[model samples]
Target: MSLFSQAFRPVGSTRADPVLVALWVALILVAVIWIAPFVFIVFTSLKTNTAVMGETAFALPTDPAFSNYAKAWARGNFSVTAFNGVLITFVKVPLGVFLSAMAAYALARVPMRGRRVLFLLCVFGTMIPFQVMLAPIFKQVNAFGLINSYPGIVLPYLAFGVPYQVFILYGFFSAVPKELSEAARIDGASHFTIFRRIFLPVSLPALSALFVLDFVATWNEFAMALVILQDPQKWTLPLGLMAFQSQFQRDYGQLNAAIVMTVLPAAIVYLMFQRYFVAGLTTGAVKE
Candidate 1:
């Protein structure tokens, strides 16, 4: 224990060292529980298919088989699927962010009669089960002749994505200081210019956080892509990964390798934006 901490602590109270030691032990245990599955996935990916399917599912294989990753990559057509996933995430995330930010700002800040009612209506849509909307959504997309097209797929993701994005950002925007907006107005900056320059710039950390989440959601989305994308060329990694499982003869090693490959991009993306998840309490921020 540090001398300062010991001096300050009361005699009857537990020492900070024992408490800290116990807390670290608990955290390490939880971390191990969380990471064990991923560790097993990597271990199994490196095992041969026969070894993976053997009696000892949990036991590490006798020899590592790194070649399984190559086989999975080739057989899964991972290159094309990964490219498609990247393209989809790239298009959907920025578009969703802009649309949601503008809409949320308008809802939160724009003065209009019945604005509360409209905001409530928008929030109500999020409560409606997505499965219930699927039929009508599909019909509308079909009527528009967008089925089997990228727009067909991307638009629905935007539709679903925007509601939740707005829900979060509206709360954030409402919490913004009104004085800044008023000041910008006095400076002759139009609402659009102020939103683009002043309000949005201050939202960097939140925006970065939202982008990573949306990008990962778009990248990993499976059920929607399965229905919308019938063309083999347009198939995303998630759908293609499904194909890998079905087409292969229950090759668990290859499946594990593909699973690992499929997860890498989203993991990297989250790590990049994870900084924003930390809350900061800087001085000079207003209550409203």
Candidate 2:
């Protein structure tokens, strides 16, 4: 019998394996535990403030207040904030990934003195805490007259984001076979051409994974945005959510609705890139 069949079969008689049954039960319990809070949030978003205060936390809403979303959207000024969030995330994430990919390619493939040192420096950057650089970064940005603008937030995002992206892309790029580049070089392909035509096309899995991760990080980033974007018009989703909570602190339904809206984009991006994400992380792990 196949291993799958044997696993499901009785151990020695008519009864199923107790160990397998226990494992399955444990998995189900863990799944429920993880999902319970999200379920509560969704249910609460559909409830009125009166209903929320009067009813049990887990009880289904007797009268769902779908207008909560509309109210939250208007009161929170989400239209402006959501646009700002999308603009920053979409611009920063892809540009950062592309720049990191190029740096990784140079580190992995180019024959240069001190390449190892440079790569190590980039890796070391990832170890430093953002909190440590906050004051210095703010001063520099202000000196450059970038505060209260898109570039103010984006420049820092790119700077901080590139190190981790380079670390990930470097591993994947190193795993690529040298033969492909060698063959292209023999055909008179320039280094840039080889990278654009061959390396980039093959590195989609890693790139997509990075895109999703960076998208989520940039989308939800609040501290840097708060520090740099002084204008309420330039606020991102996270900032908008905080403002929404403060203004509607007593309105549980509208607050939860705003929370759900803020979370939805990142969740959608993850689901879209879910297939490549796992493969990308594992691809270079056991390189030959």
Give the top-scoring candidate (TM-score). Answer: 2
Q: All candidates: CA RMSD in angstroms?
A: 4.0, 3.1
lDDT by residue (tens digit), candidate 1, 94-179: 99999999988888888888878877877886787766777787889889999888899899999888888888778888888899
Error of 2 at 199 (Å): 1.2
CA lDDT of every candidate: 0.83, 0.91
TM-score of 1: 0.86
After TM-score superposition, the amount by which residue 132's alpha carbon in candidate 2 deviates from its true location, in angstroms, is 1.4
Expressed as tens digits, the lDDT of each residue in 264-283 for candidate 2 is 99999999899998877676
Considering only N, C-alpha and C atoms within 3 Å, which residue pairs clash in candidate 1? none
Model 2: residues >4 Å from true position, as ranges? 1-24, 285-288
Give the backbone clash total of model 1: 0
lDDT of predicted model 1: 0.83
